[model samples]
Target: MDAPIRKHNATDEERFWAKVDKSGDCWTWTAAKTNGYGVFRIKPRNMVAHKVSYIWAHGPVPKGYEVDHMCFNRSCVNPAHLRLLTHQENGQNRTGANTNSKSGVRGVYWAQGQWIARACIGPKTILVGRFDDLGEAERAITEWRIEHMPVSLRDRRRRVSGPLADA
Candidate 1:
């Protein structure tokens, strides 16, 4: 492995920026990653690159809070694209649907021949609403998320595909 993100002579802030690629809208980490997230190893332990970036730009992450990629790019270390969120808020902005989801949308699933809309916050799953119409189920979940999640969810459209495309 290359030298840890911090080396003896260089300041932590200076050394950290050296490995970032800022050519695009999202600044990406150019080095090592773990589970799709960039890792920066220093003396004590390995710190997430985006977390380091957020600390440098903003401040320390509050107790019990996590750093989230507002742009949905896991490798992005751009401070502008990052925000602090509670674990529950972060869970709300999942990047994609689960493998079992046929609707191609998260939180909306089919059960018992009707559509179910639910939001999972950690271990608990809250039912938003249910509808015979798939679109109505989707809309119910989406609206519930927007109103309830602590962080702002991306307002972009979700692509509905597979069996749910027509509905």
Candidate 2:
């Protein structure tokens, strides 16, 4: 079944910002930029948080923790929906073009009895390693991403399809 539709609008971003309290404590402050990019806590990267939970649930500047926007909209600041996650757990929810570009284990082919890991780095797809199990392939890519991509930028790429794209 399809998920229920949440409220959405392209109205002025200023409308949301007015509801935040910029001078309050970290847990209670209005954590958003004036531009309505969503509530952002000032820091190295302007961490995005939901206004209700007063929790920033995305990007890596917070360090050692993972934030995920349950609403799925980067510009959405509904605190009730934000969730904290581990770096690994956050990676599991990723969906986008970068993840879809025939990369990682998604495009690999194994011989009848073999297990292999592969990904597209740019224009070419290459082998990551040969493993005995799918779990091992997952570990390889996880390690590769941790080593090569920045914490804040991990799985940051996103792709939207279907009716939503028409907007």
Each candidate structure's TM-score, on Cα atoms with residue i matched to residue i, is: 0.80, 0.34
lDDT of 1 by residue, 1-167 (tens): 79555565887777778889999999999889988789997778999999999998999999999999988988999999998888877877777679888987778888899898998777888988878988788767766776776463552334243332444
Instruction: Go through the candidates in order and give each one's C-alpha lDDT.
Output: 0.81, 0.48
Error of 1 at 18 (Å): 1.4
Residue-wise C-alpha lDDT for candidate 2, range 53-76, written one tens digit per residue: 333333333566655666455555
* Stretches > 4 Å off in candidate 2: 1-46, 51-53, 56-63, 97-167
- What TM-score does model 2 achieve against the real structure? 0.34
Model 2 residue 136 CA deviation in Å: 21
Q: Among these predicted structures, which one has the highest lDDT?
A: 1
Least well predicted 10-residue stretch by lDDT in candidate 1: 155-164
Name model 1 segments beyond 4 Å from true: 1-8, 122-124, 150-152, 155-167
